[model samples]
Target: MPMSITLPGPAPWGFRITGGRDFGKPITVSKVTEQGKAAMGDLRPGDIIVTINGESAAEMLNVEAQNKIKQSPGQLRLQVERWVLMGHLCNVNLVIPNRPLAPQNCRCLHPKPIPLHPNPSLAPRPRRCSHPCSSHPAPPPIPGALMLPSPPGPVR
Candidate 1:
């Protein structure tokens, strides 16, 4: 889901927007300075700009998008497609934590809820484990879980 983040600012916006014709990819947030306006807002590194002040980001050139943001009155309302939803925007890796890759109830480590679901904010990830599997049954998998597609092959 696209989020509308209101960045209260004057200029610079404390962030950078890259991509579009200048970069040969969709308009994406290339950087967010720490403790900056954009950092304080919901903007992240891989967020793809869907709209800027209700203007279609996909339709505008990079320079045009920058101009729109630059000339904004006070606040900038950005409609951004999150990396989690768009899947690896700006060549960023979808981090797979060091959790057990084993199946549920397989005498492996306790399964942790994969927070990379529809809304990651809902599920906070557990801390990393230093030891190996505890020789216990893995927690039951979540129904309708996002499973990685099997390797390509002709099903015999």
Candidate 2:
């Protein structure tokens, strides 16, 4: 079951959304702009949107969802569900009022990516150099095997 809510917007939705996970997958809330209508309305990350304006969000593609949001003016309805602790799901009902976001007050939802470092525990350990003649050990000679001194001529 999905929770439904009506959001009144004067400008944009102030949130980025993505869909098309598989077939019939609900649109997911990727990011919520700070101090925007979505943030003020209590929308968060990982919210699976099931419907928009009474239309099935799961049935719509990613482009469809974007188009729907773009075409919608004034008010927009949404049905979303969020996963809570202990594998339980909580339905959220939000009525976001779209107001003109001030440029100075608006914050970016997409943050800069940070470089990831490899975990020390998962990193490969360096091999020890034990051979006396060289850093690496030489291959041992196989018993009961013939060793060729020179290369053999090509057979006709």
Candidate 3:
């Protein structure tokens, strides 16, 4: 299994952005960080980061411009929109494995298409107990063990 990592802030991928608080401002690579290389794994540079872990990145920025707003500081699932020379392209999902910067001036690429099928459902089952507690008490004492405890009546 791959070890997970957390981003301190939202890092920018290579790409030009349009429309937003920073509308008309072009988001470029090598400006974000020294490790400005496009994510070698899934998302490439210039791909706009849209969301992290299902939460909309734009919405998150609206709430707080800090990258720390992520519920947990760890590997983040990102949703982004890739702008191609052609018209708008498909929304891509990316993963941020380290600390990222706040995307105050950036915009989420776009949301990806979700499949129509609903998730599989299963009935809830009772959980098993491993320790002794309320539901199950200790076993009763042995019957004959109590009969042997009495002492002689003080040398009467």
Query: Top TM-score: which candidate number?
Result: 1
**lDDT tens digits, residues 9-51, model 1?**
6777977888786666778888899988999985777777889
Off by over 4 Å in 1: 85-156
- Report backbone clashes per prediction: 0, 2, 14
lDDT of 1: 0.58
**lDDT by candidate, in order shown:** 0.58, 0.49, 0.28
TM-scores, in order shown? 0.55, 0.50, 0.29
Across 56-141, the per-residue lDDT of candidate 2 in tens digits comes to: 77777788888887788788778776432110012311111111111122122211111111232332222322333232211233
Candidate no. 3 TM-score? 0.29
Worst lDDT 10-window in candidate 3: 147-156
lDDT of 3 by residue, 111-147 (tens): 1221111111321222322333223111222232111
Worst 10 residues of 1 by lDDT: 85-94
TM-score of 2: 0.50
Least accurate 10 contiguous residues by lDDT in model 2: 93-102
lDDT of candidate 2 at residue 96, scale 0 to 100? 10
